[model samples]
Target: MTVEGFDGRLDRYLSEVLSKTRSFVQKIIEEGNVWVNQTQVLKPAYKVRSGDIIRIVIPEPKQLSLVAQDIDIEVVYEDEHLAVINKPRGMVVHPGAGNFENTLVNALLHKFSGKLSSINGVIRPGIVHRLDKDTSGLLIVAKTDEAHIKLSEALKSHQIKRIYYAICEGVLKEDSGVVDAPIGRHPVNRLKMAVIPNGKQAVTYFEVLERYDKYTFVKLRLKTGRTHQIRVHMSYIGYPLLGDSTYGRSKNEFGIQGQVLHAGEIKFVHPITSDVLHFSTELPEYFLEILNILRSRNSKYHV
Candidate 1:
C-alpha cells in the first residue's frame, strides 16, 4: 500500500495499517515481498517518507493439516446459522503456537463434522470471538460465511454485549466504575499486555458485587474488545484480577491455574433470524469453590 500520513518504520506501518501481527509483517519483509517506491526493502526498520508508494504481495495461505479431535464441549444453543457454546477453563479456543490439539475448534470440528464457516481459515473455522485459555465463557460460532460477516459487523458496531465476572485482588472503594484505557503489547514482556499511551482504545465498566478486606467480586462489561483488555485495565487501576500471573501476583492461595475471569453472558442479534439472542452460563466449579472459601474466611474475620 502507498504510504500516506504515517512516517515510521515500514514494518510498523504495515502492522498497524493491515492489522497483522508484527512477526507476520517481519516475515513478509524478510522474504522480499514488500517494496517501497518500486524498490525492494528487506529491512524491517526502513524509514518511509510521506507519499511513498509501498506495495506488498501476500502469499496464499498453506493448507492447514489440523485434525478433528473428539473432545467434550458444552453446547448451550445451536441452530442452522450459529452455535453458542460454554467453553470450559483450560481449553484453548483454537489451535496455535504449542497447542494444536484438544482445543474448542477440535471439538467443534468433530461435532459439526466439518460443517463450519471457513471465513477465519481452517484453524479457526467457525470462531467469531475468543476467550483466554483459562477463561471459561460463552462463545458464538458462525455456521456460514454470511452469518460470520453479520456477527462480525455487530461486534464492530458494539451491538453485541459481553459481560464478565472476575475476582479482583483488592477491595475497590467505589461500588461501580469505568476503566478507559488503551491496551497494547507490553514493551518489556512480549507475552503480556499493558496499558500504553498509543495503544488501541479499551473501555471496561465494572461493578463491585461483594467486597472483602483484601478482595472484591466484580462484574465487568466490555465497551471495546482488545486483547487482554480486562486484565490490563484492571491492573492499570490497581485492582488486578485474582490469579493473573502476568498482570497480578504470581502466587495465590486460591489454587487457581489462571485469572478468575469468566464470560458470564453474551447478548446479540441473530444474523439469520434478526431476533435478539442471549446466552448465559454459570460460573465454573473451581471458581465457585474459591468463592466459597473466600466467603467463609470473610465471615470468620467479620465475626
Candidate 2:
C-alpha cells in the first residue's frame, strides 16, 4: 500500500488502517515482516512518507520435513562439486506456497541425499538458480557449499551464460535485437512481472532463427537475470511467447500447456577446477514437433 497524506509512525498507521490491534502491528513489524519501500523495517516507530510503498509478507507455517520421492530426473552431467540436470517441463523446481510435495528438490534429495549443498536452507537445497514451472531445460545444482558460493558469485557478476529457444506469437522482422527493459512486479497483480520505469535492469538478446507466417522461432540470451526476464521483456515488446497465458493469450493455436520456451544451452566456469564448461541440449520432442508443424506449412514463409 502506498501511503498518501499519512505521515506518522508505521505501527499506528497499520493498526488503524488494517483494523488490527496496536500490539499485533508492532509484533509483525518487530518480526521483520513489514517493509517500507522494499526495505524491511524492524522499528515500529519508523516514520512514513506520503509516497512510500509498504509491503508485508506473512510467512506460512514451516513444513516439518521435505519428502524424498522416487521421482526420476535426468542428470546430464555431474562431478564432485556440481551437477547439471535436464529438468522437464511442468515440474516445480522447489516446494513453496500451495506446493509441498513432488518437486525437483525432493527428487534430488532422493538421489543425491547427503551430497547436495545446504546453502539455500532445507527447502531449496542445492538450488543455485531456477526456471519457471512451465519452462524446461538445463539447470545447474551445487554439490558443496564452496562450489555454491563461487557459482553464485559468478552468476551475480553476470559471468554465467544462459541461452534459450522459444516460439513466440508473432513474426519478428528484425534478424537480431535486444530487449533492454526494467522489470518489476506488476502494479496491480503481485503474481506477475511487468516493464516498469522503477524496475530492475533486464536485458534479453534475441536472434531470429525461423520466421513463419504466424510465429517466429528465436534463440535468446540473458544479460541480466531478473525473475521472468525473457518472458516479460518479450511480452513488453508486443511479441509474447506462445502459450504464455500470464502475459499473452491464455489459449494459443497450438494448444501447448506452458510457454514455448526452453533453456537449451548454458556455459560457465568450473568452480573447483577453474575449467570452462559448456552444455547444450536439443529442443524437447514436443517443442521440435511444433517447429516441424510450422515448418511444413511453407518453406517460403520461413526466412
lDDT of every model, 2 decimals: 0.88, 0.89
Candidate 1 weakest lDDT stretch, 10 residues:
294-303
What clash count does candidate 2 reach? Answer: 0
The window of 10 residues in a row where model 2 has the poorest summed lDDT is 56-65
Candidate 1 lDDT over 1-303, as tens digits, reads 678898989888997787554656888899999999999999999999889999999888656578888898989999999999999998999999888899999999889887788668768888899999898999999998779877877887899999999999988989899999888889998988888899988999999888878899899999999998898899999988999998899898776668999999999999889999998889998889888888887875321
Q: TM-score per candidate, in order? A: 0.80, 0.80
> Can you give the lDDT of residue 65 in candidate 2?
80
Query: Candidate 1, clashing residue pairs?
Result: none
lDDT of 2 by residue, 1-303 (tens): 998889989998987677544555787899999999999999999999799999987556344288888999999999989999999999999999879798999898888875787667678888999999999999999998779878887897899999999999988989999999999999999999999999998899999999998899999999999999989999999899999999899898788877999999999999889999999998999999999899889667565
Candidate 2: stretches off by over 4 Å: 1-64
Model 2 clash pairs? none
Clashes of each: 0, 0
Off by over 4 Å in 1: 1-64, 300-303
